[model samples]
Target: MTSPLTRNEQNSKSRAQTFGIRPDLFQAAQDHMVKKSDLDELSENLANAGVRGFTAATLPQNIHLGSPDSGTADYAILPFTDRYGPAVAAHPEPPSLQIEESGLWTVTLNLGTAGHGLAPAGSGFFEVSIYVGPEQPAGGPVRQYDFFNWRVELDHQQSFATTFTVDFVVESPGDFIYVQVSGMRGRAIEGDYTRTRLSVRKTDNRTR
Candidate 1:
């Protein structure tokens, strides 16, 4: 004849069965059987594995181009229309990326444009530049042009459709990244209803 199981033993078995954990291996039975230690371990492992996150922003239609008198280097607010329609017209609030993870992050700047016919037939030229800096204030001096920048050019012969791209790495957390469009000339950008986009994300070199 076998003796019936005690109340404590019954509850332990019940919790283990419900949680799909072995009763013999499940040690935390009192004051909640779910182990906090196990959860903490899982989270730590995930962080060490280098989980990645990213965000993207698109140029707004009819972006304010600084007057030609101000020159391309002058400060001009480039509005951005989010993935959807509406518009993010607020100043200093243009699309930006807030880094939270410390790893190798990449920023890809893309611009698409069409000839504005500003120049004579077969004589047009379009130029645009992207600038990036670390935690740069809304209005900072252009003397710090060394952060990172790239310029794309299209002449009458190459004016149909143009896309420019630039890639670089960010190695610290709490670092903020933004874009500035400059050195634009010749024809206007193509996306009037929509506009170019900038994307920032993390990448693991070991996996490459």
Candidate 2:
């Protein structure tokens, strides 16, 4: 005859039976079981590793243009009235998207123009520039990065549109990105805010 099992042994045997495993195996399984704390930590890490980005756009009624003769002598930043993203703001001179984390980023600029008025009688062109740099103090100068241009023949007035893209690395936070547009001499370039947009997105973990 065998002696009856102790209360703890009986309870262990009952749990093992429920799992269809031997008591020794069930006891070892406890070591590999996932704990609640471990799951919570994983959730937090995933949230921190998510992607970040920003977009700033304008409307047709609020688009800004220089004098007809303003020409290509210089570039003017596009006044973006609407913005979407966590790091975008309306201040700090030349309003821009402020970088909150360091990483490789892709910047895109889209521009469109309608032929509302008479352009020069000959050929003319429009230029688009993308600027990226650290936040500047009030009245500080702007720095330029990527530059693109679209040539249009003034033989007949028509519509124009183009997109520019660039990839660069941000090594530190607090950087800013903006867009500017210009036209050839003797012609004033105007934008259709309905088709104009600027965006910046973090694409990688690189910071080089």
Please, what are the lDDT tens digits per residue for candidate 2 over residues 44-127? 978756555554554334343434654433445665545534443111223555566678877777666654443445555555
Q: Which ten-residue region of model 1 has the weakest summed lDDT?
A: 84-93
Off by over 4 Å in 1: 1-51, 64-77, 81-95, 120-128, 137-146, 156-167, 184-186, 192-195, 204-208
**Segments of candidate 2 deviating more than 4 angstroms:** 1-20, 31-35, 53-74, 84-93, 135-156, 185-193, 203-208
Model 1 TM-score, all chains together: 0.51
Best by TM-score: 2
Per-candidate Cα RMSD to the true structure, in Å, reads 8.7, 5.1
Residues 24-71 of candidate 1 have per-residue lDDT tens digits of 445545446557898999999777566255666666564433344443
* Cα-based lDDT at residue 55, candidate 2: 47
Give the candidate number with the greatest lDDT.
2
- Report how far off residue 68 is in candidate 2 (Å): 4.6
What does candidate 2 score in Cα RMSD to the true structure?
A: 5.1
- TM-score, candidate number 2: 0.64
